[model samples]
Target: MWIQEVGEYSKKLLDKGTGEDVVTYRRVQGGEGTKSSQQRIQVNGDGTVTIPKKDADLNISIDNGEHSNYFKNEVRGGNADIVEFDVPKWFDDFLKENTIPQSGYNSNPLNQGGTAPKLVDPTKPGNSFEVPAPWVEWIEEYAKNAQIKK
Candidate 1:
């Protein structure tokens, strides 16, 4: 039989202005008796909380419901690091204003006013085609210039 005893716990206030704090939990285990102290929780200055990734008793769910599915099984013993990324709001506005629709591309071709080749496939649902090399070169040039900041 295995046994786990939760010993004395302590909570200390870190940055009172930012409402940051840290909680430590003492756990005792093993056949005879072994004592170990772990920093169970930490509140950062930026409002982000940090917790031990291993040997920590935690229960997490998507929406905080009682009948929620177990999320620990989804780990599959892979990398557990969580990453965060930021995107400028202007990028979305620029794409919406600059991008050409599929219909617009079909109407205009690189060879402008010249007859373009077409292929019909009965199995496919809609017209499938590739853009001309001239258009691709122009797009690449535009992307290169757009990424540069003045």
Candidate 2:
């Protein structure tokens, strides 16, 4: 018995199924004594994208509303072909778990200047902003009246 080995060729073909058409590709890589790697993107006939299960889960877990809106706008409104990104793991955790402080801006150290602060008269140079004690008191009192204490 004799067997013949066929050489690999790079090509794309359309697969017909259900109602939607699917496309697939096969490519050959490497040369001589080197190793070869093949990568392909697969899409289902129902128009759903095929990605690794882990990636899908990461998408669900990250679930950033801002990023979700941006993606929808870019893909649906802007009609982009491809969007790719890398976000830090900590950022994913932050988006998944972080919450807005219930104290509003009045109690946060970063917002110690209070809400609607105004700049004071220039005492020396470029920027001379000051948080008025009256504004801080009013904001705190408003927060208290609004029952937003935290």
Candidate 3:
């Protein structure tokens, strides 16, 4: 166990528009949630990826669509995201009891940002960017209508 979930329960977006039959969110079952965390994406030789996370180590096949593109174009080049990381012992125990997802998607799902975000887990040192919460379903709303903006 290397990753975990530690946050308030989140909801699944049922619908996102105003109308008579619209629901913005729905309750997720207990012990099931989405949480955000900084993860290490390790592309493997067998066309797969190994993500070490607080929840569990995820092995993903890079055989189609974006996964394939990412493996081919960015894995061994400057586009590859590299960071120095060290995991503490306590966090491992925490993951044994919770779920920290290794994958997520943005609401709009487009690759059109000129600048990537600079996010850090303020609790740690050296530009730390790791799991933000233990477990809580999360989604990126990087759009014009985003509620959070600088």
Candidate 4:
């Protein structure tokens, strides 16, 4: 069951972008009557998943720009950046079990602040602004339901 869940979650992240990635953080369990398990999966540069000490939280971010020609053009010109995913035990095991590629794992260019050409607005003619629809959607969905334990 855990394996299947991890696979599905990982697939969703990959579907978002070729250069996209994910991070999984496991929380140490404690206390009586509390499940001795908790986990979080963050889609670097976009969304996050927090499996509270009890319930699981899923946050998915889809980058519409990835589906756009402009983004691909930037990648071709070496101006495109890649997001990273920190492998979780479940995901790691799944990768090993399926023998899938692990090239993108732990490779987050955005976190490293790698240099990439800023997305330009073609319609604006000389405007060097890029729409962050992917991050926007991620924030809208994840931020709204995120549990803020302040």
lDDT string for model 2 (14-119, tens) is 2333332221111111212222221112234433333332121111101222332333333223322221222233322222232222234456564444432322
lDDT per residue as tens, model 1, 1-150: 000000011122243344434221111111111222222223344433444342222221111111111111132112222111111223222222332323344575532432222221213322222223332232222221011000
Candidate 2: which stretches are off by over 4 Å?
A: 1-82, 94-150
| Stretches of candidate 3 exceeding 4 Å from the true structure | 1-76, 100-150
Candidate achieving the largest lDDT: 4
lDDT tens string, model 4, 62-117?
A: 12222223322332233322222333334334332332112342354532232211
In model 2, pairs of residues that clash are none
lDDT of each: 0.24, 0.24, 0.23, 0.27
> What's the C-alpha lDDT at position 138 in model 1?
27
| Superior candidate under TM-score, 2 versus 4 | 4
Clash number for model 1?
0
- Stretches off by above 4 angstroms in model 1 are 1-86, 109-150
Clashing pairs in 1: none
TM-score of each: 0.17, 0.18, 0.20, 0.20
Worst 10-residue lDDT window for candidate 3 reads 141-150
